[model samples]
Target: MNLFADIRALVLDAITTLVTEGVLPDGLNTDAVTTEPPRDPAHGDMATNAAMVLAKPAGKKPRDIAEALAVKLADDPRVASAEVAGPGFLNLRLEPSVWQALPKAILGGGTAYGRSDMGKGEKVNIEYVSANPTGPMHVGHARGAIVGDAMASLLAYAGYDVTREYYINDGGAQVDVLARSVYLRYQEAHDLSVDWPEGSYPGDYLIPVGEALKDKVGDVWLEAPEKVWLPEVREFATAAMMALIRDDLAALGVHMDVFFSEKSLYGTGRIEAAIDALKEMGLIYWGVLPKPKGKAEEDWEEREQWLFKSTDFGDDEDRPVMKADGSWAYFAPDIAYHYDKVQRGFDLLINIFGADHGGYVKRLKAVVKALSQDRVPLDIKLIQLVKLFKNGAPFKMSKRAGTFITLRDLVDEVGADVARFHMLTRKSDATLDFDFDKVVEQSKENPVFYVQYAHARICSVLRKAGAEGIDVSDATLAAQDLSGMTHPAELHLAAKLAEWPRLVEIAARTHEPHRVATYLGELAADLHGLWNRGNDEPALRFLQDDPVATQSKIALARATAVVISAGLGILGVTPVEEMR
Candidate 1:
């Protein structure tokens, strides 16, 4: 249960009682009231702003109200003490039983311990890793994939119906380059030497695609003109590239629920319909944009081009939907794709884009606002660049990828779990330095290893207890007398455990999965801190000479392990059962 929520209800109930008993005037708005962990833990378990927020509105002094409220709250069995702190902030101390019951709640809830009803089962569509379908995914795409997948998992745990999606950029000019690159590979497969000229993809990853094409056709298109082979080859090569991308994603434990093809936007009335919808809302018009502000400006030509009234919805300027040549601009298909998502009846939409796409955010949000009439909210998370390093220097580029570090290379170097966890250790908006040596280091400073070591430490303790015939399983330890677990250091762990459910809600509400990672790090630190303490103080040791005491202490440590496993499950990281 959410103790903070329960306490807030108690405060609200007391306020309602005060109003009904004529202690306060009627019609006082309590919307601004909040209950949260105080800035200093010594103040109390929680602090409420009910009196402070209601003082001016109720035409009463905050201290006067807080004094009365404190007495009322302290009378409840759940509240051990209530003090009116500075400026009438009500600080609350909960009974020790409240903190002691946390482990039981964790055991009962299992993986659902931190799950929230915040979204109320609302449908959310998350689109990420929509890299150009020209080659295998690279390091940059890995970050987007992990963030998006973890976010989807977080939202789902928070009670949102989430759909993980990928939008293939097959309709762009990049795919045309991909087609020509594959043609060269096809020619090579036919024993003809071909030069991969500038502007062509020279990655050896496509070598197999070329061979596959030859295997399927068997020289049928060997002597054909461009018209005879380009169309079929383009389709064939695009499929092959998508397959390679899927395999790369699979290697990192990412799976998409939907794969939307950009090419589908063409040869259909979808783009026209999306533009028409905007037009009906008076958001579509014909316009010309200004030239570059700083750089050498191109010849400023006044031309009538189809544009969206994005400025009305907070864009820098009106965005183009159709070019003067009657072909759709790049933004046209994106708008149509988001429109399709809206029509599919999602309550929320999230797009994970590379940091370079920061400029596109406003226009995209504007289109969603204009089309969905502000019903569906869109949030764009920009993933910053990942700088890879090895041996204290920059890692060399992948010869297979030709110019960038492919996702497979990173996964092969470090397993999928490490790649995913390390990618999320930094905030999505912050540039991350992926030091190959540091992340894999077996020290407390390494987050991935540190967290995993906490889990492994618990495992080691359990094994030690078992070998000594202490019977330290969950069933045995849970049955032990835990009344001796009253030390401040021990109780402090329970206090941190109490924050997990609230932290999950906060992270999910803000659409920041990195918060979960940060929380996990803190939890692991606290666990390790307690473990290290046991070394200096034998009384703090988890496995004591007495089986009963050992069971109680082991119960506490195992509970920490359970919570860590649960948090890692949300992050899609596999907890290490042992530290090798």
Candidate 2:
């Protein structure tokens, strides 16, 4: 089903033949050989650089190797023509029958037409949306959730054993602030006056948590000291916020396989174990770091503390894991968490963080390399901020989240499908503008609607064919003769379908899910292009005077729909059967 790969193998076979015939040298490396779509469509259907790359190594002229390779390639039944272009590049044209039979192959494969086994079942761990459980999930966390969840799905489709994970930042000063904030609301439940203080969460989302706490321990800790109430309140408030966070993720269709607690790493010797591993590798040390630039030496407190040699792995300077006060730095627990992941036997580790964490990337990668002794690879993706707009003005959301717009707010404003699709329309590293007006527009300018419309149009075609009593079943259409589908427009759409499997491997290999969004947009364009042409050319329409001949065209439409469903599934989007 991978047409490009099949053609590349054919080129290699011809190269081998030339080696045996003494036309080319033996032991020539064909590993660099590749067959890809030609730069210009007028050149040919496909092009190869086998002769150009092998010419110098084989001690042969480029044109000589190309001429010999071309003659050998012409013998294949699949290749209609092989022409030698400038500088010994070989451009190929496949038989029209190859494109004509694509619909049958696509229908046979269904949504799995582009699924790949590229990863060989390697275990991968993707950690994302590790937002603090202080309030409801916000728009930034939503971006991380969609990107990470979609990445896990894409990797799974490419035959990787993927685990979705969330790391909770509960063991921190912020949790203490959240605990105190809930206490204020608890006092309000008791009808007591409380003063508003700085560094306390003012979100009304904590009101319910406070009321629930009062119900559980009615007036028992009403005037208790901080020592007695802080711990219990911290634990209770964190649990409540996590519950709310889970509900928020559920509303957006994202669920994690694991929810790791930062508190778990404390008092468990896990941090020590991770640090010891680095020490054993000579990557951990106690030393005074050089005074930072732009700061006067008198103002800097140069202290010797336990440090990680992040510079060895390209960090600008060594990073301290434990400050002189014997308290763990923010990066300390992260090292232990990643070490735990390595111990779990994951072959690859991926993290999605906010763009502001750019400075932490190299150090994080260094620690994972040190802990795993370079056996494990870590990839970190940074998600930029999202700007929301409506009617060319900044859109304001409800006060449900208090200060920031919550994930639930975004989903409510434009259902989960539109939110998820529009979030990925741009790359993760780029700032995305989520305009309420533009995304919900039913016009072709809206990519999500455009793609969904393509699928819905296909469904309409199938239903109409069924209503007319035409046998449009896959079995019937797949068996119909398609040689009569010789129009340039029909063949163009089929050629696009042939690129699906190849596109899957590229996107999965690069760890980029935005490419799936990009590909779907292009595929929809081709399908719509073919559909639009049918308006002027009556012969190009799917439904013809002859139901039997119409079956072949319907098969092509079905194939396009099948691929669209598969792509959207990876993005965690439901394909629309009909647009309202």
RMSD after CA superposition, every candidate = 1.8, 1.5
Residue 66, model 2, lDDT: 88
Off by over 4 Å in 2: 61-63
Q: What is the lDDT of candidate 1?
A: 0.89
Candidate 1: list runs displaced more than 4 Å. Answer: 295-298, 468-476
lDDT string, candidate 2, 255-311, tens digits:
999999999999999999998888888888989999999999789998999999999
Per-residue lDDT over 1-580 for candidate 1, one digit per residue giving the tens place of the 0 to 100 score: 7788788999998898888988888998888888888999999899999999999988999998998899889888989999999879999998887777776666655566777899899999999999998998999999999999999998998899999999999898888889989989988999998988899998999899999999999888878888889888899999998999999999999999999999999989999999999988888878787764675646555678998989899999888889999989889999999999999999999999999999999999999998999999999999999999999999868988989999999999999999888998989999999998998999988999999999999999999988988887666665666767776777778778888878888889889999888988988888888878888988888988888888888877888888889788888999998999
Give the top-scoring candidate (TM-score): 2
Candidate 1 Cα deviation (angstroms), residue 489 = 1.1
Candidate 1 residue 566 C-alpha distance from true site, Å? 1.1
lDDT of candidate 1 at residue 283, scale 0 to 100 = 80
Candidate 1, pairs of clashing residues: none
Candidate 1's displacement at residue 459, Å, is 1.9
